[model samples]
Target: MTAEREAEFDFTHPFYQTGLAIGVPREDSAGILRSLGALLSWQFLSLVAGLGLLLLAVGSLLWLVERRRNAEQFGGSPAQGIGASFWWAAVTMTTVGYGDKAPVTLAGRLIALVWMFAGLIMVASFTAAITSALTVSNLQRQINGPRDLPGLRVATVADTASAQYLTEQRIEQARYPDLPTAMRAVADGAADAVVYDQPLLQYRNRELGERRLDILRNTFAEQLYAFALPAGSELRGPLAQEVLRVTESAEWQSLMDAYLGHR
Candidate 1:
């Protein structure tokens, strides 16, 4: 139903509400530069920094265990041995296994063996940490709700209440011919979001079947679907009473679920 205004036909008590919602692509549709930029965010950088520190710590421990007795591989001045150990730690963690260095002492060999497994575990953890950081950064690029629409490429159906709402908020938008096109615009990276009726967006997205889009849970500028009648129609009062009764009934809920889905 069209969003109601008192100047038009008389509207009965609202039987259903379809609020305004934001729709965005399921995956990050940002450009390569944007993706690289997201990868450089503080969280990801911190993880890399932590990994560097962990490698240095492991290398220093190995250097201490080998410097005295097994100096041939882990020998030389303190700085040189630490540098060699650091190189070993880097290559071993990455599984490159250069095979140039070997620890000969019992304690040194034990430290090296322990570090091999520890490096594997740390590398796995570091990879997971980076992936999580990137995913989080990608999600942050997607809008959380209406508050994020400002300064973003907002798409909406032309000549709609949603467009009007955006205008009222002084938000510039790219108006499309219809909802599907607006949704497509977001998927195609032409727009950041599609603002439309909640239930309508839900139904349309389900039709896509690819889960290419995700609708924000938050709804704003709610619109009510009501029965419209001729102005001052004699049936308005009685019809409103019936609508309220039916809409409030359990059977009505079951019917809604049967047709519209279980929300």
Candidate 2:
């Protein structure tokens, strides 16, 4: 129970320990421009450009080694040789094995052999790096935890503890009438993310069949779920006893596991 409620009523010992969690859409194709911007990130572009430069350097080296003797495949002129070498580097690195170009001289063959092995490693590394970059860009919305709430377009249910917490913390939010509406604000791109009770967000996330929403594990603003009784109510003592008794039992753990799928 919040301090505000505690002053008016007696509450049993907390039965459940939960916290506010952040929820975000896994993907919202709502903004084509935003997706494109992420795809063309500086890190991604730099990797591509760097690979291109590597190809050029390898192609130039091959031309220097093969231009005099194996001119048939290397090319006739300096310009032609460089262009042919470029094609060779690309095909070789990709393992296409077009058979249109083959190094003849010992030096050229040695260089090609070295490139073949290096290309395998480079290709695998670049592929993994690009995939990771895209995945991070797509899934991460700069809201990893509570500290990221500042200046974010956060959504939450109005008149709830989550809302009160945001207000007291001075974090700006777009309050909705309920949890679904607040979560929908995030899915439709109206808000960057949603903040709400952990169990509520988790349940809603699973119910969203499309699996578009994900509840972050970064729980904050811990809350206690308790039974509030009228002042001086006799049931308060018995209820508190029951809560503590039940919560301490193995059956409680089993119940939680059956419903929440055991942490």
Which candidate comes out best when scored by lDDT?
2
Clashes of each: 0, 0
CA lDDT, every prediction? 0.81, 0.85
The sequence of per-residue lDDT tens digits that candidate 2 reaches over residues 1-263 is 98888999999989899999998766455345455666688988898899999999999999999999998988688889999999999989888879999999999999999999998988898879877876665555757898878877899998888999999999999999988888888887788889999888877666566745768887898888999999889999899999999999989987766665522
Which runs of model 1 end up more than 4 angstroms from their true locations?
Answer: 1-4, 27-140
TM-score of each: 0.56, 0.57
Model 2 TM-score, 2 decimals: 0.57
How does candidate 1 fare on TM-score?
0.56
lDDT per residue as tens, model 1, 1-263: 56356667888898898789988877544656456766787877887888888888888988998888878888899889999989988998888989998777787678778888987898898878767766765665568888887887899999888999999988879999988888888777678788988878877776666645788888999778888888899999999999989988889978876665544
Candidate 2 deviant stretches above 4 angstroms = 27-34, 37-140, 261-263
